[model samples]
Target chain A: MTSAPPATPVPAGVRATARIRATADGRGGTALPLLTGEGPLALRRTRGEGAEAGVMLVGAMSAPLGGDHLAVEADVGAGARLALATAAATLALPGRGGAPARYDVRLTLEGDAALRWLPEPLVSVRGSDLRVRTRAELAPGARLLLREEQVLGRAGEPGGLLRSRLTVTRAGRPLLDQELACGPGAPAGWDGPAGLAGHRSLGQLLVVDPAFEKAPAAAAVLGEFAAVTPLAGPAVLVTALAPDALRLRELLDAARRTYGW
Target chain B: MASSLAALLVLADGRFPAGGHAHSGGAEAACAAGRIHDAATLAEFCRGRLHTAGLVAAGLAAAAALGLDPAELDAAADARTPSPALRTAGRRLGRQLMRAARATWPAPELDALAAAFPRGAHQPVVLGLTARAAGLGPLDAAHVAAYESVGGPATATVRLLGLDPFEASGVLARLAPELDAVAAEAAAAARRARTEGTEALPAASSPLLEIAAEIHADWPVRLFAS
Candidate 1:
């Protein structure tokens, strides 16, 4: 029988280390701070009157549940760059206004990774923007499943919004860099004809599943959402527009079900 | 004033070709879905979007063009766009316009702006860069910026709805007085720079058009990229 690893206790005065593990929604996430030659990450968090500035060097990870948070600040050291960022990621924000509230985040994924970081949408209005700037250097036979999403506003409230930006580069070249800001007023922002198409929330699933990549025959199944365009490379994007965050999540999950993530 | 008029003419020239054909300004997909059917409705849609997305983008561009510091303008516009696709398209359009403007007329600031926003800058930023490059004053730049932005999509509707060119020009001609009025306000905005909280718009609601634009990403075949 496998025993679950214990949760690392939060240390005082902006510091903590070792292999970090966290969970939310019954799913556990782990982030290894020391990247091969990258060395140890540093996190600095300063709490003030109404705001807090936290920066992570080499950085760290956070539990996806709203009740838990991992904040830090640190300048990163340079090293050999890779392609995909495969660190298990789970983030969350618990409303603390005593009534209800919302959060917005901009997460950047930079540095070395496997192929290109294309996460399925994992947005929520306890909001988080998982911005990533990654340089992918894959060694072949490596698998990647990137789920990205924006959950708008508080579920109980009639109005809520979330915005996110993510960028992935490979071999010092841009592969996929996207900034998504979706909320209640989003549909009306463009006076656009296809403006949000009447949906308050959205999710996208990016799959580099070996089966889909190797077969090449699955082209027909994948061709519907992706094409050879000068922008965004030929990666399939299965997205859903819905009024509720859960509904959008459901749609994205269903789409990825076929990929076997 | 003559400089302003010339600036307006230059900026409003749809034929100038800044890759304008690639984007419908949200009109193509909207019209395809039957959300924006006619001129009045389109105008209504424009006013609403101008207040939210359009106003934010233009405001940022105007602020930058007026010499308020490019970094501030970038942040202001970045704060306003809550939609990733729209922002991305805005940057693409801005880049295309910068490339086209530079090829036709080389301006140092325009070149700098192109460098600053290598990946993408909003449309207004490109206009301000070009206007400044053309030696147009801030007010002059503002007039050109507001008018061209409106004109580009208006022209699209003409082809989309079979509205005659003369008829379309007539509508625009009729809109000249209103344009002048709007241009005056935009010129004022160019003087100091605007924050994300402030916006200029004619009040109207077009929920359908906005929704259509959001859902356009799902469409199987798209004529215009944006």
Candidate 2:
């Protein structure tokens, strides 16, 4: 089995697209029958460990400075399993001529499918404007575990503006619909005690599955920084904000491991 | 003419008793954190809320005022509010606001909505319908929503931080122009929402506010409900 992939930097303004799909193998298992993509996006597949199906490495050559567009789509067939991860953080540089960079992601999960998407943090440099939207559609009995983190600025610097929206639905019913805007002049009161209370880094992890509630140890593993909010449906959202990126990373990693992924 | 404009005043009034006094709109939590220690920062904080959640609320209210289906708007409200705690707070306030609106205007649609979500719909949904029952237009409803978005927080700060009442009032007055601009945009968006569906409404959200509201809800000792 190969180790984790290394970081690569892709140029700005290029649109990258990747698509992966799971298929039923003859041995009562699933395989990545459709794995292909283009542009700055790269995907590396490795053998699965434990009860996993496979692991895919998602990487880019350079930071999406400004005006860059990246689109990623993944599908898990019934009873399949896949874990998607990134090699390094993506920096949101200042917009070239005030055009906000864009990142869009879509995921589809079939019956009894499971996926884990743990992307690296996005560092928003000063004067940068970025827009990111993610949509997830899940069929009955499907499961998804995802995490997202953002740092307003580099160490000793103020952060840029980032507007992100995340929408998840299960069997055509809305499970979670969240929109977050941060950085300079954003609506959220980052300095407020009720808000970030002066935290510069924010992280969120979401778990969508019927089995989520059955596991009683999940909340205990979240620790102090992260707070888990279980919804009325089969979804739970855990959020945390920290004074620095390191703390946020530690908290989210702990949460990531809590799910046993 | 006097009564029509007075209706707007009555709904926008801070003392109208719509259960808004209990919510700092996340301001109490902000103040407790020392993010808003003075008048200047308080103004800035209110400005952020006005443009983001305020604008979104105004848009939803305007759509409701335009006579759109209350149930659809309620669902839209649910979609916009990602925080479970904030959603519960919004619904509670909505119920209180609904009781006040029904008593003040006595409209059948408002009665229908009250029956639909006995627990309560989102506050903006009820606020917009309440404006319609009061003979106000979409723009008027937007103004009420936009102003209250900040108004609740400003007043809450006066109590939480103990800032000068006069100074807080001044902060609101200073925000008049921006508030007007936001209300106008909300009204225009509501006009589009008529044909484009509720998706046309603004979804601007404050991550910190939503997160803080959730955290504050867990606090065993807090002054505000949200």
Candidate 3:
């Protein structure tokens, strides 16, 4: 019996790029002069109330397979307000390449502008590896509300390797910078008491506003596994852990309501 | 070398009066929630804390000990800490540590750090500077920090849960090898930061610890301050 030929390594997955630029129309309404989507990242303009402009992220195809490079950029002009959301949760899937997938998100807010980035959860499926990095630059008067949720795996399956980093800066000074690693290949004891503490899902909500500079948020616990605390800068952070995605979202929603978001 | 080693021991000692005894390093909250009910769970808690928060703190301390700018490291520490409660506790502990460090080993750099942050810097940053002032190297600083990260929580668990003292000590004893490895990794990261900048430092975080710390801070009646 002859052994089959060794499998050939596939080339890198798709390199997708998407961008959105929102500006105020000077009459309290927002204008989206730039909306570009490529590969798996699709941007669609949806109706929004008040002076805010809504943009929904629609996945055009299955993407972020191993070795894929994806990037999304959003720029909110002065006095503009932009609210961005995802149509559905993102699934990280395994591919032929041994390399991990990469997703980079860059958000910029000009003076007096505001942005709300409420994307759906990113699920780490078994055998997949993904690295996500998010960077936000805010002007002094700008405000930002961002949310991130991660589910370890689907159903009873164990999750793959997942690493995420978040960095936020205001006027070129660091406000918040943190990284989290989960699943296989992460440091040992990550699921133990001091880490995720046996939780399968985790989420965080970041709220930055000029008003917070005047009166910082008072620290409080929103649930059994969730709490809200103010940052040294003009921001408030809510962090939570749950057994499932549904419970994680519920905790975050409760925190948002408590903060009047 | 012998005096420096003594300094390392003094710095790592719980009786050093750094006010670390007042903080449980999230063990109090975990204890209250029944997550750390005994020696085994306490060991699990310490193991997790050792790898995540402990590693991060050790990296910062190592960087500081390498003679990096205290102000920059303090800002980096602030960036890495998302929970305001933990940040506040760190600064208070930093202040207490700074006072002890200055009295024990007077140095111009320590004076400058205190002047720059009158309120207090982050505890890990102060610890690194203290190690520097004591003629210790980055590795020594990392070792001190890595041990402190779990030591405080381990000691606190004994008080909070009334666990066996010998078991608590055994948990720490069993973790000695891991502490050594974490310190080495942290020191290497600090060495990388010399050329790569503070961004090279470890940013690993434990989400549950941050959340629990915030909750613990608001507890009307709690044994530990954080």
Q: Which candidate wins on lDDT? A: 3
Q: Can you tell me the DockQ of model 2?
A: 0.39
Q: Give the lDDT of residue A121 in candidate 3.
A: 94
TM-score of each: 0.49, 0.88, 0.93
lDDT of 3 by residue, A7-116 (tens): 87579689998999999998989999999999899999999879999999998876678899999999999999999999999888887867899999999999899999
| Candidate 1 per-residue C-alpha lDDT over A1-261 given as tens digits, one digit per residue, 9 for 90 to 100 | 598889765332212322211111112212234322122223222121111111222334332333232222121212221122223323333333222222222222323111223333333444332222222222223333455554444455332333344333223233343444444443333323333444555555554333434453122222222211112332344544567766766766676675524
Give candidate 3's whole-model lDDT.
Answer: 0.90
The parts of candidate 3 lying over 4 Å away from their true place are: A1-10, A258-261, B1-3
- DockQ, per model, reads 0.16, 0.39, 0.76
For model 3, what is the alpha-carbon lDDT of residue A87? 95
DockQ of 1: 0.16
- Candidate rank order under DockQ: 3, 2, 1
**Which model is ahead, 1 or 2, in terms of DockQ?**
2
- In candidate 3, which residue pairs get closer than 3 Å at backbone N, Cα or C atoms, i.e. clash? none
lDDT-wise, the better of 1 and 3 is 3
Model 2, residue A51: distance off in Å is: 5.8
**Tens digits of per-residue lDDT for model 3, B1-226:** 4347777888888889889999999999999988899998999999899888899999999999999988889988998898888889999999999999999999999999999999999999999999999999999999999999989999998898888899999999999999999999999999999998888888888988988887787778999999
